[model samples]
Target chain A: MIQNLTTVWRFRHFLLALVRLDLRLRYRRSILGVGWSLLNPIAMTIVFALVFSKILGGDDLTRYVPHLLIGLAVWGFLKESATAGSRAFLQSESYIRQSPLPLGIYPLRVVLGQAIHSTIAIAVAVVVTLVYQPYQPEPTDPLAILSIVPGLILMFLVAWSAATIFAFVNVYFQDTQHLLEVAAQLLFFLTPIIYTAGKLVGKAWWWLELNPVQIILELIRTPLMKGHPPTADRLLAGLYLAVVMITLAAGTAAWLRKRVIFHL
Target chain B: MAKIALTDVSLTFTVHQRKRVTLKEYLIQTVVHRRSISTAVSVHALAGVNLSLRDGDRLGVIGHNGAGKSTLLKLLAGIYPPTVGTREVEGKICSLFDISLGFEPEATGWDNISYRAFLQGESPASLRGKMDGIAAFTELGSFLDVPVRHYSAGMMMRLAFSIATAIEPEVLLIDEVLAVGDMAFQEKAQARMKEMMGSARIMVLVAHDLKTIRKMCNRAIWMQQGRVMGAGPTDEVVDAYIASVTRTAAA
Candidate 1:
């Protein structure tokens, strides 16, 4: 599946075209236009902060607002990418059933689009964080911008693989659509997107440490938010986890390549 | 020479059929038969069929629906890998299996054409430049800016046919798509197809129109019940296939 990375490069126009459609049609009738991208996260953040931090006996989470915003921005993109990627082919069955593309590329496009949307949110988050608490993030934290490159790459892989795998699975199983949704919902809480590892005290923290999403976001957030470089060891561990997810996704793509047309 | 080669290529599909599930049956199937399940059938869509094509060969395939004509075209186009035997082809191939396969109906004519052209294998930058040309060919005029779903079926076929043929692939596989358009569009499409044949390309056409096949194709293959009944020059092959069908119906 990876052999054709350059093939997709050749279809750069198709990818850009899809990205244009995704952004354009996403809120066509809605009045807000692209402003909705910024509005959604800000609204969600305010609601979560008000509901969880204030209404519940939640601790002072003012510092956690930026943290939560960052996590949500990343998670929202990842989740949306996964959701879109998995359904890309099924939604575009009219196209895939006829045209000759690698098929794996469609899901990758969904992820890239989602990542672009996430980037917008990240930009919004950066501005909002600085405005709310200018003194907190260190000057060195701008180096964290470098983390975007790796984050984007990993996000693309996850989206590509999920889309490719699901494109086949949903066609064959039909029930897999529901199964994946349930699984995605479960994975949402397992990852420390809403709360931090620091919040979980002591011996019980092992599960949080084991969560790959935690490691991935930390690799991203530490450099950008704290102005500190993520340790070499943590980066390696995140890369290892990413490799496993990508391999599993590729395996599904190889298995499904021939089978996809049958379903179509 | 630009060509497509199929050496004893075949494809079989395994389909799993489930017991029709009511709410109760669904629960039982999920809970009890989750692992030990037994309800499926296998279908063989294509049997070993050898064929080869050189540039300028417009080979027509005629058969009943599901007679593997489309399957053969797909294999030649490299959309489906053959389950057995080798299928090889040289030069770029474009397939028009369905008239509206690549268009996003909700997208504007300009955006969808650019996207569809690229998916058909044109370079992105080139597709960008060719967008106007594609739209102009559609004859949709200013309506080209509107979403495609608003267009009638004839209009959609015109747009799809225009974008597909615009790329001028070295090998072109076309299903029975031209039948959908109006007479004028059909004439235009036929002319475009004839123009394409004059170039260095192999054309594999699958159609129910025997007259059109006779007019356009140099060679023809007639398929029946997943087997080839006759293969030769267009008139000879069509006559043989008709006689066999007549005999079968009489019997």
Candidate 2:
């Protein structure tokens, strides 16, 4: 694992170039360029606020808008990274066949590329927060910035782990990408992104506790929405989940590294 | 010194006859009907074979399509792990199987050069000094600023070949990609390849051009049906391979 990490670090320039190339290719023909990244979450937030605010029909509009926007932006990152990472190896078959590099770099490239897009989404969230001042209390906690540190790191690790695992399975099972798409769609609704976790009680609350996505959501959402760091228990739980996911991802990648070439 | 040794190495590829079924399809199929998915068909790409190479070895591989010449090169380059045995390689290895394999069509020639070299594990700092030389060799001139998609096939090959051959490694692996481009570029490429072959400690080339192999390689291997049919001095192997082909054609 150390050797693999070293190899990846040594080839960091290549990975960065690949990420840049992916971003350029993705938006090359579009007139708006990277404006789409910011627009996507903003558009979704407006639509969700319009529908849910009408259904719930309460004074929760100000509170819910920022919550939904942040949640959607983060979820968008997770969804794109996981889905694209799953196809990383398959998509880079040309490079893999011709050049010899550590296989881990491909998935990392996907994750990092999506991370950049997600950073843009986060920037949009910040702008929305500043412009609309949606938080009822207007979170003044100076530590809120510090709280986001762990959440961001944990989010990247989880996304990277998921992507590596997906990329590995995708080589042998071509349907993994489609499977991930369906799974991500289901997971979006299941997680407490649109609705606050505080609203759930008893059985519903138990479901949220069991859901890793909800835990991750809380890890990030608590800092931004509630003006507080996540509870110690919640932080520990998120860390443990991240660790387990990374371990499993690394184990599977090591076992499948050479074998993936055959499938490719 | 560079060295490569294979001990009874073998590779098998399992190709699925049917497309992979999604979870949705699988669940629906299981519920609606009682049918299982099709199994994959395994192809023995390379049978058990043992070979060894040391410094200053120029090994030429000649075989018909699907006869495992490329597979052998891939194995040596560490692209595919042996399914059965073991392979030990020492040195920095550079494999140029598909010259244009990693080029982004929408990226400019200069960007593609950096991208391709980076993929080969060259850092931007290390490659900066070599950039001008590679650019000049490609002869793309102002075309370097244009996207590779706009370049002609020959121009693309020139750019790919230039970037691929820019750096020298301890061991070099080449497939038949050198067969492209104009006659002038081919001669220039051949000279560049000869220089690379001389500088590299170990070189393995897979090509169909018998004359080139006989002239360039010290030793050669002829493969038939995933097994080495003959291995010996380059001249003898080329003569025997040509004779077998001509005799089969006559028959």
The list of candidate 1 runs beyond 4 A from truth reads: A51-62, A131-148, A175-177, B15-31, B34-39, B249-251
How many pairs collide in each candidate, listed in order? 2, 0
Docking category for candidate 1?
Answer: acceptable
Expressed as tens digits, the lDDT of each residue in A136-193 for candidate 2 is 4557674674687798889899999999999988876678898898888899988888
- Writing each residue's lDDT as its tens digit, candidate 1 over A1-264 gives 556677778877877888878877886898987778778788888888888788785646656677778888877876776666667777777766676677777777777777777888888767766665533445565555565566556655655666666756666555665666777788877777776667677775777667756767777666556655677787777777778778887787777777777665
Task: Tell me, by lDDT, which candidate is best.
Answer: 2
| Residue pairs that clash (backbone atoms under 3 angstroms), model 2 | none
List model 1 lDDT by residue over B1-251, tens digit each: 68877888778876657522233345587788885344557777778788888877889999989898987887787777888889889988777766676688789777778787777667766776777778787888988889888988888888888887788678878888466488887888888877876563788889898898898899999986556777889999989878877999999
Let me know the DockQ for model 1. 0.46
**DockQ score of each predicted structure, in the order shown:** 0.46, 0.54
> Model 2, B1-251: lDDT tens per residue?
88999898889988877655565566677677877664678989999878899999999999899999988988888777789999999998888776767678888999999988887778889899999999999888999999988998899889988988898889999887466588988999988988998899998989888887888899999998889899889999888999999999999
Cα-based lDDT for every prediction: 0.75, 0.84
Native interface contacts retained, candidate 2 = 0.62
TM-score of 1: 0.89
TM-score of each predicted structure versus truth: 0.89, 0.91
